[model samples]
Target: MALRDFALLVLVCMLWAGNNIVSKYVVAYLHAPPLFYAAVRFGIVALAVFPWLRSPPRPLWRLLVVSVCMGAGSFAFMFIALKTASPSSAAIVSQLMVPTTTLLSFLLLGERLSARRLFGICLTLVGALAVMWDPAGFDFSGGLAFVLVSVVMGSLGAVLMKQMEGVQPLQFQAWVGWASAAVLIPASLVLEPGGFETVFSIGWRFWAAVTFSAVVVSVFGHTAYYFLIQRYEANLISPLTLMTPLATIGLGVAITNDPFDARMAFGAAVALVGVLIIAMRPNQAMLFLFNLRNRAR
Candidate 1:
């Protein structure tokens, strides 16, 4: 890749990383309602991307399904998770989407997963469990379930996205933004009483968060990602993008002042290692040897 493109990739990662911190602050500090906040964020994105909605490449049904899964479904659960769970925890759990996507693709799309990938998936699941094993204040009752729901939805969306053809990234994003707004509006009103009024009364910090999510994270971050995906192979891109969760963890610690416990650190390391292995699709024997060497170091 060119230096310019590399720089752009870095910028995209930073935007995504910062989004974790923004989400935590918005839901926790600013007291934004998750569904309502997501609705507004996508509403703005819809408006911003409206012009590109003219000539969509994919079938309307497929596009709509993709939008529903990737936009409304993913954001709804993600916002709920961010509201209650620590940003670091949310970031780590979100990594489950990768393995989930792989498994789903094998089942639904008849895509083949190599033995190495399967092992990586197993490791990732184990790491996820380790991360979730916090004894002191682990609460899986409420919003965390929603986050897991989002992970499943996101995985489905990703697999479907691979089957889609001829859709430009911006066009796809436009569909996602508008469709998410459409679904989220009614859902927010029904699920969250007085949601519209609450959003209107929010302070500028909330608005800033909304703008960052809509413009910077959704627009710039996703756009850069699509650009990289277009330029490079999926395997190459996927491994590097794993850095997003790590970045989020760091940002969560710095911004939200979330505790950086050993469990979180160790689990994140393991999950990330597994993700890199799966994404890179290296030989299992080599990966095992490499892992052993790293441990010895």
Candidate 2:
């Protein structure tokens, strides 16, 4: 990749990393109800992508299922986890998505994994769990469960997405944004009293955070990422995107005062390496050497 594009990828990583901290503030600090907050955020994305909502993407039912799973369901669980969990820990837990997707593929699609991938799966799961054993007040049992559920939802949604065709990134986001808003907005109204008032009373920081998440992260960030996905191998892109979790951990410590110790750091490192292993292409063992040769130029 050119230096300019590499820099762009890093910017996208930063935006995604910052969104975690920003969302924690919205739900935990501001006391915005998690479901309602997610509804509002998705609403913003829905409106932004409404143009693409005119014609339904093919395989409409599958798209709907994927939208609900990945959009409203996954995000609802994440925001709930964010309510009590440190963003750093929650971000670490979310790495389970890579393994979860692999497991799901094996079960649902009968995809066979290499021995290396099976080891990666076990390694990633154990390492992700290890982080929660923090002696600090960051209780993993509570928020960790929610994050795990979110991971499963996201992973399954991705598997379903592989069965899809002709669903561009914008079209997919439009479906997710609109479908999520449709479900979550109503659920929030019924379950969360004063949902509307909270929206009205929020400060500029609140809107800024929401805008950053909905626009910067969802819109520009994913679009640029998809652009790269088209240009490069997914394994190459996946390794680089690990920067998001690393950045999130730093921001969570710096901004949110998240507890971090040697054990947690080691566990995070192990888990990310596992993710890289799982995300590697079939020929990645050889390709890494090739990449090293290319990068030396």
How do the predictions measure up, each by TM-score? 0.93, 0.92
**Candidate 2 structure quality by residue, lDDT tens digits, 163-198:** 888888898899999999999988998999887788
Model 2 weakest 10-residue run by lDDT? 133-142
Q: Which stretches of candidate 1 lie over 4 Å from their true place?
A: 136-138, 283-297
Report the backbone clash tally of model 1: 0
Task: Give the distance in Å from residue 126's predicted Cα in candidate 1 to where it truly belongs.
Answer: 0.7
**Candidate 2 TM-score to native:** 0.92
Candidate 2: list runs displaced more than 4 Å. Answer: 134-138, 286-297
Candidate 1 lDDT score relative to the true structure = 0.83
Give the CA lDDT, 0 to 100, for residue 51 in model 2: 91
Whole-model Cα lDDT of every candidate shown, in order: 0.83, 0.88
**Which digits, one per residue and each the tens of the lDDT, describe model 1 over residues 1-297?**
788887887788878888888887887777788888988899888888888888876578888998989999998889888777888888887788888999999998999898888987887887777777767655585366677899999999989888888888888889999999999989988889987677678778888889999998998789889889989888767777876787888888888887778888888888877777777746644766588899999
RMSD to truth, every model: 2.0, 3.7
